[model samples]
Target: MATPPALVFSDLDGTLLDHHSYGHAPAAPALAALRARGIPLILASSKTAAEIAVLHAELGLGTAPAIVENGAGLWQPGEGSSQDASDYRRIRAALQALPAALRRPFTGFGDLGEKGIAIATGLPPEAARAAARRQHSEPGLWTGDDAGLLAFAAALAPQGITARRGGRFLTLSLGGTKAQMMAQVARRYGAPLTVALGDAPNDAEMIEAADLGVIVRNDHGTPLPPLDGEASGRVLRTALPGPAGWNAAILDFLKQLDRRGGARTDG
Candidate 1:
């Protein structure tokens, strides 16, 4: 398939940057190449707007808004249209259904006065301790491990929130899938051929929805779960990890799109 001059929608953290609690370097040359070709890189991540803002500055991106809190809201550069009002309403409704004890310790973007929002799962002290000890490694990143996080999620069963782990944090949402966020943004941009890159389950929806889905290899050099093997002849897998992986994925897909007349470069 040919790649077009397209909006390359990517996730932050593990997919594009190491963010080893210290923010690693990106493939600056490759990224510069993309920019030189007039491709706009859009960040879609679980990071809060505040966090994403810092990253945007670091990445040298102007003000491209990101999907914060796992697609709960969309942020655009110089635009604050409040696209996810319904998603937030649903999130609040879901939170209201939970037992008071289960909801007390949580906070969100609204609570922080538009800085960013999040809903906490007030885990039991001991369980929280275990979660902190085993599941969570990066402070201010995760609540705990898969098992521990899942347990915490279970406590919110009544409220219907799911805990998904991303590069720096665990997020709760009222079933806000990344695909939904991607589609919404794509629509605004006339739904151009999308190239989505991510490295975890939370990104599954967006990856599948993209014209091309590229899953970055994990820390162990393992690829994220492949698309349904039988029907996904279009899916691509990358051997590269971190920034290198992102560069590879974008360059390769753009090549494919160019070859097939699916995309074009400005220069």
Candidate 2:
């Protein structure tokens, strides 16, 4: 594949999409600019491939792979919805193998069923079904105390299952991060300049790894603490929240790149 000037990796729920409505209409302008400039926008999220594929097609990303299942897997364009679920199965098995005391506190998607997922995520029934079709990771609520959570993680460590706390859930996977996937995608595109935008702690690695990082304001979730990049002016925060903030931060950054004669206009 030919190299583009830059690759943009973004988190979906609380970054490029609204926290409550899950809409991206507010980001249309920046999305248009990216398309015009030939910059590929890679959706990086904790959402499943089944879930991400819908939005990926809606956005017309055309063949760009997405980081799905919280980076436990990649969703290549045209790939079937029935992806390999071995990893997800392994994660589930590991959870089951834990002592009952530890296992009982974590109610994963597999345990929740479609209806429970719908209630938990506030997604429609159909969407919840899609979200439940996990291919690589297990996200669940951790009801145990902090010490118990720590013990749970330690017990799972022997099985190569790591836990990550996202905005609302504790996710368990064999362990690939958004930043790791970002680097892989960048290499596939010939290592172009990278930009990452997100709104939560799980997004921190990806944001910090990028050449330019954006922390889209997300008043609905735990605020990400100030990162080191902010002091260097390499990372920026938005005044608006969700897609609106995403739009403004992206446009402003691209403009700054243009001013510096660094924005790529050629394909």
Candidate 3:
């Protein structure tokens, strides 16, 4: 049996890395297995490029591009391209321009500085600084009623902005989403069998778009909203949390794929 070329698109904070500990130690086996199979692991995260780049390097992913800032844009290391880098200033301006009622309850990282970000995210001062170096998106805390949140998002939509509720904050970015970026990357790789894992609603689009959608369990014990798509039976849910759940799903899927003879096998 043969298998199609495959790649994995994953969320960071709660999918590949732990939510509280911020480590992927539990998924080490899966990480090693993916490397062994020569699979391309693309990071799709709400974290800024500066933050994703640091983790990517530590993971030994050499110069591989990442989908950063909640898909506000992509980051290609060593390539002096991508217009997303300069979009932050404009985004901030847009936020301020929103009606005072729509904007007042939200406090973004840009407004907080590194120290604020550190306190908000529980990252150390140094790590928080990296998180604060946002290029394409604005992640912030929303301190308002649900109705106000909806109103804010609606207001931003007319201005080519989007608000996504992440695990810890509400992220504002350009209209792009993980699904859009995932499609672009899929094209770059000749449209191989795509597998995506995520644990939050902000990730619903990408998860539904993948050939194999895996909803990993989150630390809060709440699963994401239902992933609606035309591809039935292609979506799956993991029972374990963090990387352990991530590992379980990938291994299980690979076994099913091998049996189905969907693509070329690495071994």
Candidate 4:
């Protein structure tokens, strides 16, 4: 069978985009390189659909489907979502139903209005509003004294929800993970040699699920914890930090792929 183009699932913040500035300029060369080769770069991020929608346009990714709200929803090209998406209201309701003590510590976006979100996220007021447009998960700074967060997690567990800790906050989603969504995306492309890039614990599953795993160095000046299969040759970690590291690693991976003549192999 003719080999399909390699599918790339990339996390935005701290990976493809700068952790602080939220710019992907350093990765421009790599992005262009992939574009030239017709590689599909699917942005899978914790950002909301509104946020990713603007970014998709900025990146010139006309109508390509993007995984939004940390895989709790999918955004296809065109007017709006082509598929059924998750309901943030349900997540909020569940949180509201939790015990006051268990819920008080989790300062989620639901509690932070646009202004507070803007201040906390370092985003502009409008951008913060878009971020608050949650469809699946709720993200916020986990400010809890003692074991409150642990109790919160336990409370959420039985509700079919989980908290994914990122650089700044813990995101709560209902049985949704980037890895699961990426695998669903793979089915669309005949499962071409999957490569995933990420920089934090939230990305562990997606990183592990990839045929080629890329651990992009974060701004913290450290790499993430060991993924389940990093000992093998399929995983790579960048030497630099931020998008500079992201660019270099992607270029290297592409060159390696080119060495195989653009053919997807089972190896």
| lDDT (0 to 1) per candidate | 0.60, 0.88, 0.82, 0.81
- Model 4 gets an lDDT of 0.81
Q: State each model's C-alpha RMSD to the native.
A: 8.1, 1.8, 3.0, 3.5
Judged by lDDT relative to the true structure, which candidate is superior, 1 or 3? 3
Q: What TM-score should be assigned to candidate 3?
A: 0.90
lDDT of 1 at 130: 26
* Tens digit of per-residue lDDT, candidate 2, span 76-130: 9986666578888999988888899988889999999999988888899999999
List model 1 lDDT by residue over 229-252, tens digit each. 316555666687777888777777
- Error of model 4, residue 237, in angstroms: 1.5
Q: In model 4, what are the clashing residue pairs, if there are any?
A: none
Off by over 4 Å in 2: 264-267
TM-score of each: 0.68, 0.94, 0.90, 0.91
Scored by TM-score, the top model is 2
Pairing residues by index, what is the TM-score of model 1? 0.68
**RMSD over all Cα atoms, model 1:** 8.1
> Which order, best to worst by TM-score?
2, 4, 3, 1
User: Per-residue lDDT for 58 in model 4?
Assistant: 92
Clashes of each: 23, 0, 6, 0
Lowest lDDT sum, 10 consecutive residues, model 2, at: 258-267
Our model 3 lands, by Cα RMSD against the true structure, at: 3.0
